[model samples]
Target: MLADMRDEVFDQDRACQALSHDRDRLVEAMDSGVADIDRLTFPDGPLTLLDLAVHVTMWDEINLGVVTLALRGRPHWSLDPRWETAEAGGALNVGGVRAGRGLTEELIRHRFHAVRQAHIDTIAEIPRSQWEQELPFAHSGSQPRTLGGLCHYVNTPEADPTRKLTYQHAAVHLGATSLSRAAPTGTG
Candidate 1:
């Protein structure tokens, strides 16, 4: 039991630090005014720098709900029969981008900071046992089974390889390749 508590604290610290670092980097990018926030970064999709901020914000908002529900020991509301028809987050992603479209850059940035802080706060307060409890939302192969796993997933580089656009390119003015070799840090 004591060992489990230590592991939970370590995981929680790492997650909160990562989220804080990610939020600062993204915010610095948006405030820099160097990148064309609206310019599409990829040919395969309509993702702009602003859209990326919105995308992350959307996921943070969703996770907040998931974490809150799990903390309360409530069955995940999304585990309904209608999940059969859901497009496994493709729809959610598309709708997130669409919802962010045409919004002022300031609004997206505001939400990016607010939602991230909320997520970090929530993660910090979650009980040790709650962190390990398997979330009902883990249906997809990529989905993490526990709240701790979800916290790690959203903050790590593998979750969004294109994170370079928001981190290195915009924040540090470095090449994308530089971030590819960088490891996830425990420091904020």
Candidate 2:
């Protein structure tokens, strides 16, 4: 049973399934909210739906790149010089949001959907056997340094205890709290 569980853990199909499930939840959550994504704003939250879409798409793009590189026997260490450091992640998010401003609402939505599809498609390309292959870079602590681990880490937020199985980052952004909040004063 241990071997079966281990096999399932690193299986490409399982990884894609988890990713697709979270993406569906996020899309459903977004669809049920304010119809005008350009005007969808959260009270006390820094991002509008447009901004949030850009931010999420940016991370998806990054994940796609990382997985693509790993598949080619390359290390993703230089994708961000300080990618391994949690403190630097906020800056990356901030920069993505800033850079994505001025994009049309339609374009932002399109990119978000397209990039997510590409990310899942890329993950599906990883072979079952190589899913557990250790990545070239050194991982923090005993966290699995395999290809599956990289995908799991990028998808799951630091605060989530469930780790490998959930997309807590998407939940943090598109969850009930974010959906229910009223727009902050003076912003749309």
Candidate 3:
């Protein structure tokens, strides 16, 4: 059983590494503006470049905080929208209007790079033994998940498929069929 657990930890480490790499690539690509971040779409609707940037930043912070808590054997933060929104406001503290006032591609890029680096560092510092330990996280409210499970949730093939479908739906809803049409097959 210990060997199995160790193996799982190794797998989780690999997965975390991959996620870090992928996130780095995403930050690089967005910073480069090669793909036009302004046109990015989410599952809910179209996002302005600033909106996408904010979402990415928020996602990184939330995920990292969860992983950090898991490593420390503490309850993860609540995922209640109201609570999270309040928490996010306190942590991020920048409003859209304020963000828009002085936003530049370079600035957004720098922020994302910093955020990504912090996540990478957190993942690297945590020990493998903690991967199997349950920590509180919240999709809707505080719940428990292993570090390995969180890693898997973020990168699982199933998640990719689901996100792709969600993006397609968003495109359709927004009358942005061109975006959906341009998406590569098997993107997820």
- Candidate 1 — worst ten consecutive residues by lDDT sum? 1-10
Best candidate, lDDT: 2
Question: What's model 2's TM-score?
Answer: 0.71
lDDT of 1 by residue, 22-122 (tens): 56666666667445333223334646678778877776787677667766655344444364343655576677788898799888878887888898799
Name model 1 segments beyond 4 Å from true: 1-10, 34-46, 75-86, 133-146, 153-188
- Give stretches of model 2 more than 4 Å off: 1-10, 34-45, 78-81, 159-165, 176-188
State the local distance difference test value for candidate 2.
0.61
lDDT of 2 by residue, 1-188 (tens): 01112112335665566556556656665677653332223343566666777877887887788788878878666345577565566677677787788788788878988998898788887777788888777544234778887676566554333342333345555543232111122311
Instruction: Give lDDT tens digits, candidate 3, residues 68-90.
Output: 76666664553345645544544
Better of 1 and 2 by lDDT: 2
Highest-TM-score candidate: 2
Model 1 per-residue lDDT at 81: 39
Global Cα RMSD, each model: 7.4, 9.0, 9.3
| lDDT of the candidates, in the order given | 0.56, 0.61, 0.47
